[model samples]
Target chain A: MNPFIDIRNDFPILKQQVYGKPLVYLDNAATTQKPTTVIDALCNYYRQDNANVHRGVHALSERATVNYERTRDDLVGLIHANNRREIVFVRGATEAINLVAQSWGNANVAAGDEIIISAMEHHSNIVPWQWLCERTGATLKIAPMNARGELLMDQFDAMLHARTRLVAVVHQSNALGTINPVAEIIQKSHAVGAKVLLDGAQALAHMAVDVQALDVDFYVTSAHKMYGPTGVGMLYAKEALLEAMPPYQGGGDMIRTVSFERSEYNDLPYKFEAGTPNIAGVIGFGAALRYLQSLGMDAIAKHEQSLLAYATDKAESTGYIRLIGTAKNKASVLSFAVNGVHPHDLGTILDRDGVAIRAGHHCAMPVMKFFGVPATARASFAVYNTKDDVDTLFVAIEQAYAMFS
Target chain B: MFDLRSLYQEVIVDHSKSPRHFGKLDPCTHQADGHNPLCGDQLHVYLHIKNGCIDDLSFEGDGCAISVASASIMSETLKGKTLGEFEALFDRFQQMVTAPVDQPVADDGMGKLTVLAGVREFPSRVKCAILCWHTLKSAMHADSGVAKTE
Candidate 1:
C-alpha cells in the first residue's frame, strides 16, 4: 500500500489550506503533525482514564496506572532497551538532557575532569554541559565537525583521554541532517571509561533506534518530533546507571518513604520521574510508536530516503543554491542557502506558497558559525511526506530565486 | 486582500539593496545600536543633531532585506526634522505599521510610509521593520537627557 495515501488520511491537518493553497509541511525537524490514532488516544485518555497514578486506590487510578506503565513497555521495545526500567519519561528531550547533566554529570565530573561534545550539538546538549562544567570546574572540550558536518572520528578519539568523563553528541543534527556514527562513538567512549549520551530527538522519527545495540549510557528523545504530543519525552538509560543517579527533583512520586529524619528514593526509572507525569501525552506517544511499528521503520526510512534524494537533486539543479551539510550518511533534512537571498526572506517567500520550512539557526548556532553562514532554510521529511512535496519545494525555491534575481 | 507577494514588493527590495542613508556619520552627536539576536541582525544609528534639529542621519548595519530597507527609510524620514517633530513622525509611523489598513494618520502625512504597510501581514517581521525606528526613538531621547541609550 502507498504510505502517502494510507497515512495522509490519518492527519486531518494535511488536508487544510494555507495561504489559499494546500499546506506542504517540510518542518518535520521542528515538529511533526499528529496522526488520528495519537489524537484519538489523547482524547480517549482524558475522557475515560483520567486520574492520578500510583497513589489512588480507585478504579480510574488502576486503569491510568496500567496504561502509563504500558507506555514504558512500548518505549522499551521501540528503542530496543534492555528493560522498561531504563525508560524514564520527562517533559521533553531538553529536560531529559538536563536531568543527566545535573544528576549524573554533577555527581561524576569533578575539577579538572573533561566532558567532550561535538560541534554539531544542539543548544540543549551544549548548555547543560556548560552549566555542569561551570559548576564542577570541569573543562568542556568540543570535537569539531568537518565541512560536510560529519564529526572527525580521529579528532574525537584524540580528544578522549583519562580525564574525559562523558561524551555527549547528537545522533542526527537537527540543522545539518548529518547522522553521526553513534554506535562507534559509544564503543569508543566506553573504551576510555567515559559515559556517552545520544541526543536522539531528531533521529527517533527518521530511522530505527536500538539502545542495546548502540550501548549508549543515555539516549534522549522528544515525542513532538515523532508525530506525538508535545510536552512529553523519554530518556533511556542503563538500569544500573539509572539506579545509581540521584533524583532530579525532590517531589512526591519519586520517594519510596518520607520520614522526618530522611527519605528513601524510588526505584530506577521512578527516581528520575518526579511529580505528576504527562499522562495524556504519554498515551499519545504510545499511539505514535504503535503507528510507526505498524508501518515498519525500514519502510519509513526508505520513503524518507527517496524524498531526500529527490529534494537534493531538485535543489542542486537550481543554480547558485548552496546545500549545507553534505555528509555521506544523512537523514531526510536539506539545509541550503541561495547566494543572494537571506534565509529569512526565503522562508517568507516559501511560506507564501504554503511550504513550511524552518529558516534560522535551527537552535544550533555553533553549527551555523562553523559553516560561516547566519542561517539556512531547512526542509525535513517524514513518512507522510512524498516526492511531490519535494517538487513543490523545488518550484517554490525556483520562484524565490526568480523573485530575487 | 492578503497578498504575500506584496509584502516583498520591488520597492522594498530596492530600498534594501541600496538604502538612502546607509553609512556611519563619524563624530555624530547622538548614536545608538540595535540588535535582533534571533536573526543576528545588527544596526548602528548615528544622528547629527544641532540646536534640537536633525542636521544629518545615517545608519550602518547587517540584516535581512526588510530590516535594512526599514533602517534606510527611517534615516531618510528623519534627516531634516526637529527632535519633537521626529518623535511625532515616529508615533505616526508606528501607528501606520501596527494599525489596521483602514486607519488614517490624523495629522502626519503617512502616504509615503504606506510602503511599510505590508509588514503588518507578517507579524514575526514587524520587529525587524520597526527596529530602526525604535533605535531612533532611543537616540532622540538620549540626546535630550531623558535617559541613557544603554
Candidate 2:
C-alpha cells in the first residue's frame, strides 16, 4: 500500500471546487495549503489553551509556553540543529533574514568589507544585504550563473577572498526549482573564512535538510512554505553565533533587565524573539513538523521526484511549449511559456479551467531578466499532487495556445 | 469562472496578432514610453502634431491582447483628431473601460474602440488596456520620462 495515500483528504481546502471544477493547487511555491491536522491544532490552541506565554503564572500560560517551546525542539530535529537554543522565531523567512542582517550583519560587517550573493537569489536575500552594504560602506558582490540556471562555482570561487565576510544564497530557487549545490557552496565559503547563510524557503518542504550535516552557519525558512501557518518562521544559527549576536528587537520577552542607564538582553533564541510570540502559529508548526515526521522525509522526497520527472517528460513532449529553467537537477516546479501566448493570458485561461498556477516573476525579478522573459507560468507540486494534476495542466496549456494563436 | 470570450474577443485577438499603426514615427515631435512593471508589458507611443492637431500617430512595443488591441484601436480612432478632441476621447475611453459591467458606457462614437469595454469585468487588466492612453497623455505634454502604470 502507498504510505502517502489519502493525503488530499487530509487538507480540507483541497476538497473545494474553484469556479466549476476541482481546484488544482500548483502554487506551492507561493504557499502550501494546511492539512486538517495543522488547522485543527491552531483552532485547538485557541479553543483550549489560549493565553499569553512566558509571563503568565496560571495553568493556561504554562500550557501555552510548553506547546510554543515544543515547536523549537521539533525544529531542532527538523533541520538537525545543534539544539533548541539555536532556533529563533520571527515573522517569516523575510523577517528572519532581516533579523540576521540587522543583528549579526550590523555587528560583523564594516567599511570596505564584502558580502557575496548569486544571480538567482530572491529579493529577500539580496535586498537586506544591499541595504547593509549601503549603510556600512561595504561592497556587495554577485556570482554569475550559467544558461541552465546553475551557479558557476568557478566564478564564485574566484569572487571569494579575505574581505568576503558573508555569502548568502538560495538553497532551491522558487522561480527555477533548481536545487543548488549548497553543500559545495557551504564548504567553499567556510574555506575562505566566510560564513554561509542558505535561504531554504523553497527547499524545506521538498527535501530533507540537515543543518548539522550541511554545516551551514545560518539557515532560514518560513512555516507557511511548508505545511504550517503563516506569520511564523525560524532562523537556525550556530548556538555560539546566536549567543554572540545582540537582540534584533527590544521588547517584553527579549530582555532580562531594563534600566535607563543599562539593559541586559535575554538568553539565546529568546533574545532574538521579541514581544509576545505567535503562540497559535507555533502550536500549528509543531503539528506540521509532526505530520512531516510521520510521513518520512525520504518517502516524501522520492514521491515528489517521481512526480516532477513525469511532469517534465509530458511538458517536453509538447512541441510548442517552451520550458524555462531546464536545470539538470530540479524539484517539483515546472515554469513554461506557450508559443505565441503570454504568461498572463495563460494564467487567466488556466484559472478558468480551475488550474491555479503562479504567473509572474515569482518574486525573483532578476531571474526573469536572466532568462530574457517577461513572465512565466509556474506550476509547482506538493505532496498531495498527482499525475492527473499534471494532465489537467497540459490540457489547460493547450487551450491557452489555441485561443491565443 | 471569468468569461475569457468576453475579454478575448475576435477583434481584440485579431488586432493583437496584426496591430494597426504598429511602428515608429521617425520625426514625431512628441513621444513617450509606457511600461507595466507587473507583467513587463511595454509600449512606445509617438505622435506628430501639426496645426494644433495630431497629423500622424504610431506605436511599437510588446504587450498582451488587451494592451496591444487597445493601442491598435486607439491609434486608428484618434489619429486625425484635434488636441481638444483627443483629450475628450481619452476621458470617454477611460470611463468606458472602468465602468461597471452591468452599466453600459454611453455610445460616445468610439467605433472599434468599444472592443476594449470587455475589460470592465477584469479589474486587473484595466491597467493593461489603459497603458497606451497614459503614454499618449504623456506624449501630448512632451514628457520624455516613461509612463508607468503602478
Candidate 3:
C-alpha cells in the first residue's frame, strides 16, 4: 500500500469529477492543486487580518506584516538559504529572473560579455537573458543537450570562460523530466568566475534544494508550482550580492527616505519588492510550506520517483507509445508521444475520461524543436498522484490511440 | 456536457484520417499560413482563384484532428464557391460555432460544415476549428499572408 494514498484527501479539488468521471489530475508541472490548509490560510487572512503590511503601525497591520514576513522566514528554511535577508519575494520565478537580469545584469554585464543558458530552459528563463543581452550587447550562449534530454556537461564546461557573466539554466526541465546536475554546474561556473542563477520553478516541488549547499549565486521559483497560491514566489541570492545590486523597482515600500534630492533603498528583500506584495498569497504560501514540511520533501521525492517509474513502464508497455526524455535521472514529469495522434487531440480525448495532462511544447519551444515534435502529451506527478492515476493515464492514452487509429 | 461522439463525429474522424485536397496548389493565386501559437498547430491554406471564383482550394500542414478535419471539410465545401459565398459561409460558420451550445444555428446552406458546430462546447478547441477559416480570410484580404490565433 502506498504511504501517500491518504494525502489525496487533503486536496478538495481532487475529489471532484469531470464529465461524470473522477478527475485524475496529471498536470502538476503547470500548477498544483492546493491543499485545504493553503486555501483556508488565504480565506482566513482576508476574513480577519485584511490589512496592508510593513507600513502601518496598527494591530491589524502588525498581524498582517508578521504573517507575510513569516513566509519569507519559512522560505529561508525551505530552501536552506542563508537567512531571511537573502530571500526576496517577487511575483513568481519569471519576475525573480527579471529582477536579477535588470538589477544585477544591467549593473554588472558589459558589452561582449557572455551569458550561458541550456537548451531546455523555459521561455521565462530564456527571454529575460535575451533582453539583458540586447540591452548590454552581451553574447548569449546555449549549452546543448543530448536526445535523452541530459545536459552535455563537457560542452557546458567548455562554454564557461573568463567573460561569462551569468549561467542561468533550469534546475529541472518542464518539457522533459531531466533533473540537471546544478551542483556540478555551479562549481564549474564558479571556477570560471561566473555567477550562476538557477530557475527552480519546476525543481522545488519535487526535491529539496539548498542554496547554500549548491553555492548558487541566485535561485528563483514559483509558489503556485509547490501547491501554494499564485502571484507569490521568491528569489534567493547571497546577501552581499543583493546588497550590491540596485533596487529592481522604485516605489514606496522599497524606499527608506524619498525626498526631492535623493532616496535610500530600504533593505535586502524590501528593496527588490517595490509595490505592495501579494499579502494573502504569501500567507497561503506559508501554509503550503508547512504542509510540505509535515509531509517531508524526501518522502515526496521518493513517492514521485516511484510514480514516474511506474508511469514510464506503463507508457512503454503500450506498443505505439514512445516516451520522450529517456534521461537516466529524471523527476516528476513524463512527456510522451502517441503513435499517429496529435497531442492536442490526445488531450481532448483524455479530458473526456477526466484525465488531465498537458499537451503542447510546455513553454519550451526550443526543446520541442530539438525533439522534432510539434508537441507531446506531458503527465507530471505530485504527492497526491498514485499508481492508480498512472494506470488511468495509460487507459486514457489507449482510448486516444484507438480513436486516432 | 460535451459528448465525445458529438465533438469527434464520424465525418470529422474520416476527414482527419484522409484529408481531401491535402497539398499545396502549385502556381496558386493566393496562399496564407495559419498558426495557433498556443498549441503550435500550423497549416497553410492555398487558393487557386479565377475571376474572384475559386478554381481549386487546398491546404497543407499539421494540426490536431479537429483542425485537420475542419480544414478538410472546408476545402471540400469551398471548391467552386466565389469569394463572396466563402465570406458569407465563413460568417455563418463563425456564428454557428461561437453561439451558445443550446442555441440553434440556422443551417442555411452549410451542409458538411455544420458538423463543426459542436466546437462551441469546447472553448479551447474553437480556435482549432476556425484557424483555417481565418487563414482563408487572410488569403482573401491579401494581408501579410500569415494568420495567427493567439
What are the iRMS values of all candidates? 2.4, 2.0, 2.2
**Per-model lDDT:** 0.87, 0.90, 0.92
Ranking by lDDT: 3, 2, 1
For model 2, give the RMSD to the true fold. 1.8
For model 3, what is the error of residue A7's alpha carbon versus the real structure, in angstroms, after optimal superposition? Answer: 1.2
Which candidate has the highest TM-score of all? 3
Counting clashing residue pairs in each candidate, in order, gives 0, 0, 0
Docking class of 2: medium
Cα deviation at B14, candidate 2, in Å, is 1.7
Q: Which candidate, 2 or 3, would have the higher lDDT against the true structure?
A: 3
lDDT of 2 by residue, B1-150 (tens): 248888889898899989999998978989999998877788999999999999999999987778898999999998889999999888998899899888968856888888888888878889999999999999999888999898
Q: Model 1, range B79-134, lDDT digits (tens) per residue?
A: 78888888887777777667765655353475456678788778778777888887
For candidate 2, write residues A1-405 as lDDT tens digits. Answer: 334668989999988887788999999999999998999999989999999989999999999999999999999988999889999898889998999899899999999999999998889999999999988999999999998888898999999999999999999999988989999989989998999999999899989999999999999999998999999999999998988898888989988999999889988888987899889998999999999888888888888888889888888898998888878888988988788888877787788788999888888889988989988889998899988888999998888888877
TM-score result, candidate 3: 0.98
- Top DockQ hit: 3
Report the Cα lDDT for candidate 3.
0.92
